[model samples]
Target: MTDPLVLGPLLRHVGETTASVWVQTGGTATVTVRSGERSWSARTFVVEGFHFALVLVDGLTAGESYEYIVEIDGAQVWPPAECEYPAPRITTLVKDRPTRLAFGSCRTSVPHDAEHHGSHGVDALRTYAMALADGEVEWPDAIAFLGDQVYADETSEEMREFIGTRRSLDEPPGEELKDFTEYAHLYALAWSEPANRWLLSTLPSSMIFDDHDIRDDWNTSWTWHEEINETQWWHERLVGGLTAYWVYQHIGNLDHDALAADEIWSLLAAGAGDSEVDLTAPLRDLVERNDRHPEVYRWSYTLELGDCRLVVLDSRAARVLEPEARHMLDPAELEWLAEQLTGDVDHLFVGTSLPFLLPPGLHDLEAINEVLAAGRFGGLPAKGAERVRQIIDLEHWAAFQSGFQEVFELVMEVARGTKGDPPATVTFLSGDVHNSYVAEVIDAEQHGAGSRIVQAVCSPIRNPMPKGLRVAMSGFSRSLVRPMRWVASRSRRIPDPAYPWRVTHGPWFDNNLAVVEVRGDGLHLSWYAGEVVDDDHDHPRLREVSTVDV
Candidate 1:
């Protein structure tokens, strides 16, 4: 029999009474999810010639573990007989249980062997998987992949070889993904690694896409969008990227209620119990419309676990690119965000792929650069500044003054107990800077509310920034704050940040994954990097880089 499951049995949206298991099959097959005496089943639906299913297993008891098996066409296909790891299980959330999450981003699909190790380092996720399999570490409630789950624009050597065998690399966009088939292949390469695949099967996961998931610096500006749109292959690239994202990443993120409300799912559900439905055209049209009018659909979501709430923002797709009124989140998204920012929980976590808070020095520089790029100096100087902004990746929260202030104020309000009973901590969890760090917002009044604001960043589950560039970044981060603030003072266009902050923990450049555990009113964060202690690539170890408590 053909291997029906290709990409997942990826456990997602696990709750007190329900669990969602996402899987891709080789053909139209009946997929069943068995947990103890209960079972949930669904038939795979076709999308661009691929069969996929999200089986929602209900009637699960809260705070209970249920070992599950995937059966395609009434034949068991998952948890292979030769598997060495523990049986894949789904644990529903308990009301009194503490919130624990593992988060990291910017993982590239490449071989885990030694030759690739020099460039990509050991895969931190894989190492973490080993730890989980060995029962060396507690399984987090969920793993939040902040961004860049797949590098659509940056192909690995293996991926390039596959692409070359199927299509000409000399075509426009060359090595980058051109269509849905390539993206599907890219995801297979990314998640098919044995250790990571096992981890994904058992652990609940949430994900959002970064620029590299589509192309580098995606939606950075109107000019960038216009230039790319004019390219011959960009239309297909956008449609495929977003469509695959919806099928693979976004679908599993939603709860049963939200999934039921989704129009795309409704369209697919309509074709169920019949011949395989080819949703390529409708899916492409949905993506195209969402691209042009981002406010038409929302990607941001929030999940409440115990006493805490995790708000995952769509930083990339929800951007407003008007030069004069640039904002990271469009008005509708910002309004939605405001609704999510309220505090009734013991802890509040905001997850953004790009950090809401940068190192103080870098923050000031980007804030100033934003004004310069907006033509505050006018003519060629502004043009040059815009180029610099794009080149150095200065576009972030600080670069959009309105967005920065709006979010800052909202966070401040939540912290101050204006929205509800204040959370013990308001933490922003992020990745994408290719480093790990923790920063705390300083409260001038030494107020209890002010003490709760913090930022935790973990990045590059495999990719590492070059040592030379790391050194340069460190020096620049240290030296730029004062001068950039001084420059901002002289420009009417730039405004000073309301709350001061400092990097309290790190700027570590190791390829790492981070975990945050929230207990009652306390928070603990730890960063782990994969290390090949000996020459054993198959059994790389997870070494703790640092841990901090807030």
Candidate 2:
């Protein structure tokens, strides 16, 4: 390959008249994106020997479709001569149109073969891409990948092969990512799949990281943090993970104004308009500062899609883990969330990596576990509780009762019309739970809010739960109903939820992706999966698994 373009021409933020394109290149070169006679160009920025650019395409007609091509140093690099699909199109959002949002999480990178399919199953996202490319389904306004886009702790055979070349196979951390270079390779492997790559190039997508993006149970608690901080490889891993995430995922999340306001963007674009900017040193400082003080930079982002307002929160990196003051979000982050929870929009969607409303019994169990881990029962029991917390992944909104309650209070305020006119529906879109389910705040303290507060969680776009866990989760969803109320009521440390909820639609265990369409009456939600018919792995068919109207 003589092209400098390495990874992406990913369509990031797109508005009525503006769009941003992100690309990773193999060398220092000017990246240009052209639509018809109009072209936009940006010089490459270097981060640890890696070159990238985010070029903004503007002044386009609203609600119009424009086929775009990528050029490196004025030579077309995208839509390679051998490409089978059409040239990627930048379709800007149409004002007043109902928004179609697709979301999922927890996908693993692996070769698509019979052996891997026996475990991981078909990639629903890729199948969706194929369908979209073939005009079988309507295009979504955007897709928000909740988390685990790449697993840092769980390496694939390809990742392990790369890791083996870099470090000793028998060493500590082993196949797990060690630094920025490894993390870079991991992202490349994750997004390089052909159908998925073409889908991403054309679809405006936003993302947030969950624990597996760095490591499982990342920032789960203060004790967990203290232990990881003591490790030799962790510091580099932390910095590298954040650095790669910023370069790969975070920058594309912001629009024109938000990108201009970003500190890192400002530094890279400071005085060098046309010259190449090397941000390796600044990136290291950024990751170090952000890890030491989580509030230094905000990973959370907000976007507007027609009548919908989407606020994607950063539930993993920015957290208060200390037992005395544990929260899913820190003080500043909580305040920001409160502000963003305002109404005035027809639909408000909060995208969290972890589900805000889990199964009632499991939620109460987590609530009690948080207290027990903090030495509520005894010192010895606290140790046991801490170990159990990590074992079953007991960290979620319920695990941090204070943050959970406070955020709910803010949500209630918006629902009650305090912040602004209450939205028709307040939906929390999430992944990372490995299963798909829908829950609704029902028959509790409404406090004058007529809005439908719901939680729609879909996950593991490629990975599937074992039959054993599927059975356990199915029974867990139904059986936890009545007793969990009593279980939660008994704990004085755990106050009753401001709004009681129940699982309304499903606890479906499938390798699936879900979509939410903002309609006139209410919201329509559906989950779909890729079914390999007749054992045809190369041409999986997209099938709808379930549908629910909110």
Candidate 3:
């Protein structure tokens, strides 16, 4: 029999009474998910010749551990026959149990061998897998991959070699992904490592895509959209990127209610049978429409775990590119986000790919750059400023002032107990800055006895920023921007932030992964880096870089 399982069997959306498992198959097959005495089976659906199934297993008791087996057409294909480690188990959330989550971003797909260690470093996720396998660390409730899950635009040497065997590298956008098939290969390369693969199978995961998932600086500006749309291959690239993301990442994110309400799933359910349903045309059209009009479909989601709420924002796709009214999240998305940012929970975790609270100096710089890029200086200077914006990646929350203020005010309101009973902490968990840091916002008026607002950033799970760039960033954030802030405030004519903030921890540049635990009224965060101790590259060790409590 053919190897039906291609990718996943990834555990997702584990709720009180329901759970979802996503898997890719080789052909039309019955995908079965078995947990204890309960089992659910569903036939795979086809999209652009790729077979996938999202089996929702019901009747699960909350706070219980259930060992699961995935089978395709009556043959056990997961938890490999020769496996020595513990079998994959789904542990549902318990009401009184504290919530622990692992988060990081910007992982590159490269061989784990010692030769590639210098370029890629040891994969922190892989090392975490080793710790989990050995029972050295407690498994998190879920792993939130903030963004940059796959670098579609930046292919590695191995990826290039694989592309060359299948397609000509001389074509436009050569070496980068051109279609769905290439993206499939990219995901395979990213998740196929033995240790990481096992970790994914058992652990619940949530993800969002950043620029690299499509192309670098995706939707950075109106001009960027125009330029990429003019490219001959962009149509296929956009469709493939989004469609694959839905199949591989987005579907599993929804709870039972949301999944049942989804239009695409409704269509797929209507056509479920022995034969695979061809959804290429409809799926492509959906992606195309969503690209042009982001409000047509929502990518952001919220999870209520115990006494905390995790709000994962889709900062990339839900953008308003209108020059005069530019915002990271469009009106509909903004409203949705506002609804989710309530004070009912003990801890409010806002997960955005780009950080909400950057270093004050850096934030000032970006805000100033935004005014200049808006033709404040006019003519060639404005043009140059625009180019600089793209070059230095200035398209963050601070660059979009209106959106930044709106969200900031809302967060402040929540923290001040204006929305409801205040959370103990309102923490912004983010990645993509290539460095890890913690910053706390101090309310000028000492508002209410509400939440302590903090920004915690952990990034580059495998990729590392260059030393020169790190030095420059540290220097600019430390001293240079202090003077620039005065000029920026004067030029932009915007008042100072109501609350002043300072970086309290880090600016560390190690390839790292971070974990956050929420207990009662306190939160603990720690960063870990993978180290090849004793020259055993295969069995890399995880070293704790720093830990902070708030």
Candidate 4:
């Protein structure tokens, strides 16, 4: 029997004309996608020695549905013969008509039960979202996974076991992923949830990777990259992981035009011929160079939804790490980002893997990190410098101060309606910090501006922060964090403005899921946590956290 083929990042566009489906598997497979009566097949491609497919179906109507399937070794696969088709199995992209999108990231397949279940739990979020999309609940316009969709550093017990079964964990890379095979299995764990798989078959998704997708702190600084590259297997590991990430996750996010213009895309298209081509070598070189010199390419892009615009920023992989001009977004990427947000739109949504604003106290700690990172504290001793780098690796938006400041100022312009025809609302949807919360930009009048700038964060649909770290974060946020920001700035040694963040919305506690609805005059955002009831879960409930009025 042939291994089942899996598809993901279902999306539609290109003149309300074409649809694309990304597939990965143990071997080559044939995918058949149908929109209404039209059907299509994608030529197979390989990256990092893994076989995958991208099928594009043409003649789709906007806001409509379609069905698709896969066949390997002359056997039909996907939504297995016995499985039921979810509602809206395939949908054409639509405009600003109350789009219900489900988005979150940072998932680890631990036991949903309290027994610390050893087996990787079925993806609860994926399951719920699928069932909801199927019939249990309503479907969303799109699904956006902000970051850490796969954990390269923190593998689950099951993943560890799988790795151990395949190779020795006592080696230098020990328990850390080091090649294409390891990365492949990591993806299997990530996408194996049936509901999530089903959801992927239908819901158009936009994904951007975070650190855990590669390692704990993949690229916080030049030093981190240097250390990792110095390791015997680090080069292979980074190259393989990033190449697979690009082939698997990143490419699916684009439409036909973007894909057509991509250099790698052209290579893959050309390589679709009979004799096999090794995409890994060149792909590896590209990823490695991207890490070392982020300005060479553009990983960030913009998505237009009728009157609304979604600007997905590449917080990682596009950093300017020179000591003098450290930044989260390289100059080129920042320039592009600024230009995108400057465009006139009704609603502007910025998708970043890292939250732009943390709790006020934590925001202050980030400033301290800047000083420490600058070697301003304790004379930047060897030990202290390593420690500071680690801190920068841990939280983001501060690691690249110049880039962070530039993005901040740009968004602030949109929030204040600095442009002649400003976006009615500037909403940022992000994930990465294991916990989730919502922050609204308070207007001078203090009413949650309806279309006023707002931020909604949802994280770890499966992953949970350790209780100790959670406690530390809470205590630090409430007590020492704010004071330190004040004292540090007042001392004038490394003065940075204190965060004007007022938690008028929440500091909600939980490994939760969230949803945001954009109606005419208001924005409705809510969160839910997983609760196992009767051996299953019913915790995907939406509890209103807060509302903002313009």
Q: What TM-score goes with each of the models?
A: 0.98, 0.98, 0.98, 0.89
| Best candidate (score: lDDT) | 2
Q: Write the per-residue lDDT of candidate 4 for residues 1-550, one digit (tens) a residue.
A: 6455644434433224466777775665555654445667665666766777777666677766666655544455665767655533666666746645567878875544445422332344754664476465566667778888888887777788988987899986888887888888888777766666666666777788888888887677666767777889877777877887887788777778888888777786776665445576777778878867787667777766655778888888887665566678777887888788763776788999998876666666665666665666565453465575576454478555566667767876665566536666787889887667666554522432224666678877766666667766665446665676676566564547422554555555555556666676456665655444455442333233333343
Off by over 4 Å in 1: 444-451
Q: Give lDDT tens digits, candidate 3, residues 473-493.
A: 676557765676777678634
Q: Model 3 — which ten-residue stretch has the worst lDDT?
A: 441-450
Q: Write the per-residue lDDT of candidate 1 for residues 1-550, one digit (tens) a residue.
A: 6688877889999888888999999998889998767789987887888889999888888999999999988888898879988999999998788899999999998998899998889999999999989988888999999999999988999899889988899998899999899999999999999999999999999999999999988988776788888999999999999999998999899899889898888876777675666777888888988999999888889887766899999999999998977999988999999999998888999999999989887887888877777777777877787788888888878888889989988998888888998888889999988988898887633554632899999988988987877875575456666776787778776777778787887789888999999866789999998899779988999899999998
* lDDT-based ranking: 2, 1, 3, 4
* Per-residue lDDT of candidate 2, residues 207-276 (tens digit): 9999999999999999999999999989989889989999999999999999999988998668577777
For model 2 the local lDDT of residue 423 reads 90
- What clash count goes with each model? 0, 0, 0, 5
Over 4 Å off in model 4, which ranges? 4-15, 71-75, 84-88, 111-114, 117-124, 130-134, 271-278, 377-382, 388-394, 416-420, 444-451, 475-482, 493-499, 537-550
Q: How much lDDT does each candidate structure score?
A: 0.88, 0.89, 0.87, 0.67
